[model samples]
Target: MFAVLELGGPNLYDYYVNQEIYSSENKYEIVANIARAAAIALNELHQRAVIHLDIKAENFVIALQENQIDLKVDPFSFKLIDFNTSVLGTDHVKANTASITKIIKAPEIRKKSKNYVNQKVDVWAFGIMIYGLLYSKLNEFNELNVNVMSDKSRYSRLDSELNYYRSNPSNTNLDIIINVFTIKKF
Candidate 1:
């Protein structure tokens, strides 16, 4: 089956980093499109009971139609590939998940837990990917960083950032989203 598959254009990380490939579209639009595509793809995979344990920008390929001119149509159709580390069933593993990328790895994978982990791990990684796509920075949200995890720093950053909005309640949404990603599986 793999042999019969058509060749993919380029992985998302490479496409985004290379101005030549993604130069035609607006920056914000491109990011938004990629996020939408990724969410839909992940959702479909989860619905099928598959877990893409190694979800990252590099693992997602940009598919272009045959005989289609670049920028003449949509930028490219996003497709998730490289399932060597993926698990077919939603069962958890007792082994260490250090093999995956450190920045985007889920909390359960980080813990190297002996207990069963489910699909929530994918959701966590998806959130991280969205954050990265927006800010293009991964280190700020990494759990290993003491600066981000520190209550003082966390609140200070959130407070100043949230101050732009009139309603203070929106801050809670940010807190929940951040906390959801920061949470580790024990």
Candidate 2:
């Protein structure tokens, strides 16, 4: 059965917050809530041998409360979504690079993805989402991403690369900054 749902506003990824706009404490809560839900959901899916290749703020929806977030679970909840890039892990197979949104892609996906990858790929995507959540504080914390979100691409470079390495570790982990451009998988 189709159950109708609604939200007060668009996702944080959909709405651009200007630097002039000051982020409130609730905003932090909202982002944290979204991240938490994603993490929990990912963990559940992994337990069932499923991996969400795509994890981003755009995938979430905020509930219409004074400070609420209601994450949507359609398209992917009832049935697995984005199977084009998803790996079944039934035969230790790797996923094809063509099956995913090249941007949010985890490096693990890129590395071992001659045919398939595993749950760790989802973790990489989660890390990227967290990066976006805390990106604004980089200036204050003197923080910098290894690859930085793509200037040419949308997803965070470091997150994508790290995700790949976690799934497919190599000596080049620290050198990903320079290797990303030269490599094909990542």
Candidate 3:
């Protein structure tokens, strides 16, 4: 039944889990990108007052790659996968979870499901995902330019300093959106 597939590498989590070979660059950006996208989607859903109960790596798949990686850790592509645990309409779905993703689970579940859970729950997950991509440089948040926060300390400038806002959250290219083409964009 699960045929008609175009096979690719296993889910990234599986590689990291089983010690299989994978990219060396901190994939924190990848996770952040996924979370960012999810955040945007979740924003729309929340505007309508819906909540997604399940959010995890298994439910995410790398989407595509646009640049040539000089480093082993170069960014690849990914997308959020699996929507099976989703909860929408009604507060009774809280009983269904038994610690699948406590780290990412919305606090509202414990706060009482009647209304504590909202779109911000997904925002929390998005933050975690971005953190995953930024494990080493969480402090870069203080910087004005995310690209200037570049690690090509070894090589390559993070695009042109042309679009200054992308690097600075105050200017917030949040509307700019992250994608496979992000690193490659001039």
Candidate 4:
């Protein structure tokens, strides 16, 4: 039996690129709501023993309401899609590295090790996605001179960045990202 899925509205990447349509004040909140919804969806899928090998902005669709989108009314309007690369089970699964987005690929995936990947990789990609939404740039972390191969180096760089943001206190949205990282203990 074939199942029909709701196409929903534009994907998160499109919304990100065309964010000018939204007021600057609302953009960050919208992005934050999207991130939260996506995280919940991913967590649900993971709890069901599903591993989405490809998790990125393009895989999340924003559901529009009455030809408009109001995240305040429905924070869960965002839907995670494009599960063609997903697998069943919590064990490490082999994925096609070429199919995954480069910016969000974890260190192991980038290294192309023979060892398979588990849910932790998804968590890493989610973190990268949140970083992109907050900063509007995927290379901000890389620009800090972090050695992508070493997790310790990357975390150290992230710690310094978090410290800078904390000291400045100018960007409130950054606190969200920092809180996420702290909660994840990364």
What would the per-residue lDDT of candidate 1 be over residues 1-186, giving only the tens digit for each residue? Answer: 356868777777766666542344455556666776777678788888887776777777777788654633264467788776666667664334546555555544555533355677777777666655555544344443345354445545544543544254455445544543353679
Task: Report the C-alpha lDDT of model 3 over 1-186, residue by residue, as the tens digit.
Answer: 566844444454453444322244534444444455545555565565555655544445544344532323334444445556555753333445443344455545533334334455666665544543333222232232233432333112212321343356432224333442255646
Once fitted onto the true fold, the runs of candidate 1 whose alpha carbons sit more than 4 angstroms away are: 20-25, 69-76, 91-96, 113-115, 138-186
Per-model TM-score versus the true fold:
0.63, 0.50, 0.43, 0.67
Q: Give me the overall lDDT of model 3.
A: 0.44
Tens-digit per-residue lDDT, 117-173, candidate 2? 667667766666655554443232123323444424433545465576567754442
Tens-digit lDDT string for candidate 4 (1-186):
999966588777777667542346666666666677788878988999887877777788876776565433355556678887676778777666655654566767765634477888788888777766766654454343334456456555565665676587655777564543344535
lDDT per prediction?
0.60, 0.48, 0.44, 0.67
Count clashing pairs, candidate 1.
Answer: 0
Give the C-alpha miss distance for residue 46 in model 1, angstroms: 1.5
lDDT score, candidate 2, position 186:
56
Q: By TM-score, is 2 or 3 better?
A: 2
User: After aligning candidate 4 to the native by TM-score, how far in Å is the CA of 128 from where it should be?
Assistant: 0.7
Off by over 4 Å in 4: 1-5, 21-23, 65-76, 138-171, 178-186
Which one wins by TM-score: 3 or 4?
4
RMSD of each: 8.9, 12.0, 12.7, 6.6
Residue 155 C-alpha lDDT in model 2? 36
